[model samples]
Target chain A: MDKIKCECGHVNPEGTVLCEACGKPIEGNQHIDGNDKKTLLNMRYEGSARRSKTYTNSIVDKIWSFFSSVKVGVWLIVIALIASALGTIYPQAEYIPPEAVSRDPAVFYEATYGITGKIYYQLGLHELYGSWWYMILLALIGVSLVICSLDRYIPLRRALKIQKPKRHETFIKRQRFFSETEHVTTDEIHSVKEKLQQQRYKITEENGHILAEKGRFSRWGPYVNHIGLIIILIAALLRQTPLLFLDEYVWVREGEQTVIPGTDGEYYIENKKFIFETYSEEDGEIYKEALEKQEAMVPKNYQTNAVIYKKKGETVAGADPELEVVKEAEIRMNEPAKIGNGFTLYQAGYQLNEFHTMSFKVHRTDDQNEKALGTFTVDMNNPKHEYELDNGLTVKIDQYYPEYELDDGEPRSISKFPRNPAFVFLIYPPNETKPEVSFVGIGKNIDPTNENEYKLGIVDFDMRHVSGLTVRKDYTLPIFILGALIFMIGVIQGMYWQHRRIWIHPKGNGVLLAAHTNKNWHALKQNIEKAIANTSIKIVEDQQELDKDVSKRGGES
Target chain B: MSLEQRKANKAHKMKKRFIFRSIILILMLAAIVYALVANFNKDKSIYRAGDQAPDFKLEQINANNELESIQLSELKGKGVMLNFWATYCKPCEAEMPFMEKLYPEYKEKGIEIVAVNLDVNTLVVDRFIDKYDLTFPILPDHKEQVMDLYKVGKLPSTFFIDENGVIVDKVDGALTLENLEKQFQKILPKK
Candidate 1:
């Protein structure tokens, strides 16, 4: 490749389509055919040579060109959007039942939704957003955006920066809007310059030639938006890194603390109390109609008084970790408590009146009135093997069932929740030879042997509320917000402004006038016509309009 | 400037840009590949079949009926049956008898059954073990740490690990005696 030197004595880089200083079309360039004056100058990138257009041999050049193509970029965006839409056709695997997802998601989809769901599962559409192929699509789009902007932005910047006030007559004539005058006075040129200055155009003059440019910053709008889009895509990909994104749920009983999941055991949250209120007739007249429509009581508010704690230091396994209080706040629906390290806890749900403790009394079976001997309270969650009553009788637990149920002829529990608690008590009386065995529940009392000297009777029970908190950790939130703001700025800059340039030069005893704009050509032409008013210079005509009329007549014929 | 010299300089700049862009593209591709590979690998927090059973230490009632801490990593060379259960779970109780019956026979064949109880009260677990006469190691997860470690959503969930400590099979619900024996055979030592 040989460097081309324009007749004006300006040296240009290899593959230069037009001289950087003088704007003269370089001979032997592929973009220029023999005698280029007949066609409009391809002013995209200001006729500057771009890497993607110049190179085609090497593999790197091929890859660059592939990503630089606006066509390819548009196609990638369309395909990605379609793929994302397909993901929403059904519930994602994460939203499905936990048991189904944990055991076999394929079976669940097939069993629930039949053939389409099976196909969806088989194609891995249930987790479409997380699929490797979908991520690759997004990565390809990001790469395309970066390359497309780089392919043109560098050359455009260089062309704008290296531009001169003087340009060749042929280049000016080939512009979409062009005109000429046989005689132009220096005073008329000065008047035109003054009018352009009034219009906020930046004017540059060299040897009586004038170039006026306005809104040049708007030309960088597309590239700036592309950069913002690339940042957004990168932030989306960053979520794959561990701890950058977290969504988990934890249930903490009133007065009990629970370790927040995804915090690496570094944080814990305690619920002091769970408050639940419902709208009633006594609430207000405004909610009367809405409340009356609901068959069941409508909830008005639910909040959890939460206290966050951070682990102090390393602790041995199976031992309690020492915790230091971090903060305390009330968490309600849509109002989350912000803990440090990008974590927030929201009150998601509440279970009211869960069995917490149960009390029992030892009763003598021989007494007519079933006189109570001694009373003992049992913590349903952490029960003791034996309980000593102040009245001198002792009762020992032989068996316990938190959620008791009868299966066939055997007594067992269906679950570990203290919903329907039952217990087998061994009542030991003072100075007695043997202990009496009794089966006791909330409303049932039976002696298995049917000949016990003592029995266990239910006394009182206590219930507490459990609050469910959803913990969310998103460190990429600030980056996403920044990207969105930059994108909005780019869009506003591009849409609300236009880059306009006017070139005026003396050529062969006549003055040539040409105008160009990135968009809103009508506005630019009107501005030019008004600026060159009351001057000897002729108003510029839109050559594109004349060409379109000629083409239309040719079509009609 | 000489035309030849200017051409050479232009070529050098192009090559430099190409190298710089190539490195960036390669690095981006590498990051994407790393993310995909990390996703393909099972998260250690979640346990499933074919995953390396996460090592944990828990307290169990031994032959002396006393609380003794045992580690899963300590039984690496033995085929282990790790069962997450609670004394209140009926399905877990239904499978206990089969586990107890197979415990003696399998213990002689380099197999060990370890039950992790997700009960808040150790008394219930002890009473259940006594009533069932279960001889296998019964660990009490009083704080439910081991339960959370395995992410057990339901009771009677069992992980069958081979001698190499890799989980060979996992059942989320109750298994019959025959099914339990079959699963045990899968993790039994070859010899």
Candidate 2:
């Protein structure tokens, strides 16, 4: 191949339209035909590193050009899809057996799932999505998209911006749709321009020539879609950061307060009440029988009346710390209650079991004589509060234990029911500054010392039902939503819009017209014929047939 | 240049572009296939040692031999030893006696030892409990809910939770008598 030397001392390959070193056209490059010149002008990076001799020969340049190719981009996408599919063959590590994660995955796989499991673990299919290779594949695709779009965008923009109405006779003659007519006056040109304008074409008029183009932005559709996709990928990677997303399950039994996890215990959600309802047969005959039997009760809806509170001071266990209700709403499935910041409380599920309440009897023993102080009831759901008593004695119920048991000299609750309810109490006698601590079990005194002057004993209680809820806080949700919307728009533009252009110039007192479209040539042809109707313009032969004839004539010569 | 020469030049350029693109595509495909076969596998637990222990429910046979459901959330404000074990595991069996020995002392200080047996057979679990003479609650996790929640990977895994339901420490292997004592003390509620 011969190298064309430009005036700026740059040697470009034969058929090069633009100089590789300087942003100037190669002078007297006869190898580039009129059609090739048009295409070269439409390119974004006329003198990009991919085309420069010195740059393209380097190793980094080779790598850059490799990724800039659209074929490489498609290949990367295909690989990512296959890897994702393989990941589904075996359950991802998160969904696998809990034991499988800790031990040698190969051994666990062989012990549990047999030979296929061994192969899956051996190939890293267990955690394919999070693997370094899969991440690298995604990163490569991103690089390919960026380089591909940028390499073409600049020249394409310049070509579209600097389009002129007048072109070389051969350039106009070579278009797929061409026509001419005699006696084309200024009035005829104005009429043709008006006709093009009616079709929403952006017209640019020059002396004895006119250029009309439509859907110019359509050429940018692919780049737009690529940008949207890149944004989505970046957002997905950001979501992996711990601070950007949180998914936690919390169980706040009816009237019980629990700290929402992942919030640093700064907020608490209290379930005021849990409401569960089933579709009644009266509402629909299909559910009538099930509702009567109460056997196949299909749940209509379940909700939890929840209150979110902001912690005021340090949370002290077994004491009612000061808290202010920040937000109150009913949390239901699909209808989460937005709490402080981006935190949301969802009523995920509920449990039905026997609930329990604890009652205490206060007695003052003086000189072996026992006197009744007062009786107080402690609701297990809301027990961490002080209860004022008569006779100048104050009692604070610190904790309530259902099914209380003693293990190795320690007092604890073994079950959630009222089988053996126990209450921890701090009693302040009338004249004593120090309060007496006591553990009162159902029907018995559990305190080993039995040294308190005032005795607190659990007198009575009952059992009732509870709900479960899930809390979530995701900061990347907005970014995901915006990216999806932009992607949808880009897809519509890239797939449905077509870029079309037409040129009209005077030739020997007649008008010569030519037209081209990036897609849908048949439609472009019909549009050209419609635009030039009611005029003296004559349709020429099809551009492809004309080219074939020209080639045959050249062969004969 | 003649038309034939121009056509020939165009064909040559097209062929060069196609070859360059094809080469890159082939290389990318080869690299992807190699990665699929040679990538290393590692799985980490979702819930760490210091993270708050997720709550779950299980059914256990009471003293009267009736099935009663227990929820871990109800044990909030109390130190809890959440142990996941199986009847057939020897290490689990070996640690049962030590747990039984420490159960009473910890229970007095408001610490409960909930030994969750990941056995579907209640008869086997009952017999195992009888053999060890264990007095603590032996919850039967027939569905393995607690096991999955805790991501209990070994034969005998234990999580020690403080009064605030925060997991103070997690043990993956069977705890010896001394280790049990140390963990139990750490999980005991502050007076």
Candidate 3:
């Protein structure tokens, strides 16, 4: 390496702008970029020789400089922020119905939200966070964070570690705060050192030169913050792994058990009961006005008494497996039940008034008394084909429709659930060889032959409520929490403290006193003034003000 | 230290840090890119036409009200028409007669229609079969597991699988008699 030999018998690297051992500016170094000799020195990075500032020849150098530039990092952040805002103009793909997206997203977007939505969908903004360009933007920011921190941190640490408390007239003169004291005694210097020590500054002395330093660890704040940000970004990316994250939903009816989705059949949840309530005027006086004005009942609560079970044996397809009870809890809105294996079940929705069981009575058509010959109850979930009653009367279900409807003059069921049950019954009376056929439904009964002797009448029925639960498992939550904690610590450490240093150099029967701080120059000046109180040393003045005055005078000349 | 030695030491340290950071960066990017590519390549959540139909086993109420299970893998060699429906879906009722009509004729040609009933009540499904006089197999998805597995957003969703177990076509709504017959002919197994 080519070296620059300074007048103080110290050598510096070829690209070094200032001597490292002694703070003397090396003039006429074309590779180094800084303020002119007239103004205060740009001590942002301690006048250190950074690689980004010195090298721009190779491709690697260019890439390194590109990422290490704070300007580039800020621009990347701004672009990412704007893109994230644009994503919120419409719901993301996850918020959209999965079936609609799977069937055809383009059609759904256009039909639902018009032309702008069509354009958004076409640009792949529907899945903005997951889009390739967005991911690339995030990756670029991560690269910038890594490169920028490394570029500045290493050189600054080196500069501070090798710093000396010695004579450098120009360095002292260019400091933001500088002062000269005439005929200062050794006792005064000793008193100043004692005052600084009382203020918790570490004092170092060399050849009657003293340097008081405090809060040097605050210089590492930005680097620590960058590290935390990188960890958070990595945690966000890990969510894409299926093993670390899962979200699914299941519907469990009252008195029924369902294998929780996304558990690979290891967990089962049963809904013991579901309770849903709506606010009425009688409940409270506060909601009476709102309820009356809205003319709608507002839901107050949704709770599900649920039991979680763990599969104890091997799962066989199409067969019920043995289960062991794990825990039972009442899952309510915003109060999810935590099952084992990082799974949590949340009450999502409920279906009320679902048919449970229905009963019917067989009656004589000609009797005015409406006396029933036989009565039978049908379980909506599982009905019998035959029902025997007293006096040798029998009623047989020839056909059944759980949710009955008329299609082309024929009776049919729209669904398997007993929403509107209907049945064809063949009734047999004692001492009769021929059977009478009767069609029965919720509110309708018809005899096609019109010669039936027996009729079926509606009796009573039972209803149930079905509860919907969402199962979620997120393993990256702890990583995010850890990253946020580190970030907070870094922010507080960096913002709430300043790294201050004051250098005292003996100069011709007096001392040239100069001080510098990374931030809050006013506070550093006040500290120095207080420490030298009652001594012969005068108050320090900001030399930047003197520089301005000189420039104004030179302009007039 | 001499300026020459200090510069050499810094350069060596810089090279080491660069290599270490580069390795970490490359590994992270590789994992992210791999995940993105893999997610784009195969979305197994919703099946489409030309994909292999996912196999499942479900129990159904037989004529004698016995619990019997049927596995889709056992019917791999036969042409399968898998229909997902609920008892309350009206469109499903409109299409059942067409399915029943084609089942007898297509059974001789190695095409079988399997209706999956997404109902909580077994009696409702049994009564539905009796009403339509459906001769085809009826499998009740009691927990609606098969319904979710097929990603059937709408009722009367059907998949026509050829003899090789690959889905030839997928229909999301009620099919007309002609459309149903055409779908049956498409999945007819070769003699």
- Candidate 2 - CAPRI tier? incorrect
Q: Going through the candidates in order, what fraction of the true interface contacts does each contain?
A: 0.33, 0.00, 0.25
Question: Clashes in model 3: which pairs?
Answer: A414-B87, A414-B88, A414-B89, A415-B87, A415-B88, A416-B87, A416-B88
lDDT of 1 by residue, A191-282 (tens): 89999999999999988788999999888888778777877876776676666887878988888877787776778888899999888998
DockQ by candidate, in order? 0.35, 0.04, 0.30
On residues A382-407, what C-alpha lDDT tens digit does candidate 2 reach at each position? 45457878778888655555557776
For candidate 2, the C-alpha RMSD (Å) to the true structure equals 14.9
Per-residue lDDT tens digits of candidate 3, residues B1-191? Answer: 87688778878856775675567567656856865664554355568888888778877554733336678878888999999877667667778898888877888889877788877666566667877887777888765656656766666678999989999988766778988888888888887
Best by lDDT: 1
Q: Judge candidate 2 at residue A509 and give its lDDT.
A: 90
Worst 10 residues of 1 chain A by lDDT: A548-557
Q: Please report, as a value between 0 and 1, the fraction of native contacts recovered by candidate 3.
A: 0.25
All candidates in order of lDDT, best leading: 1, 3, 2
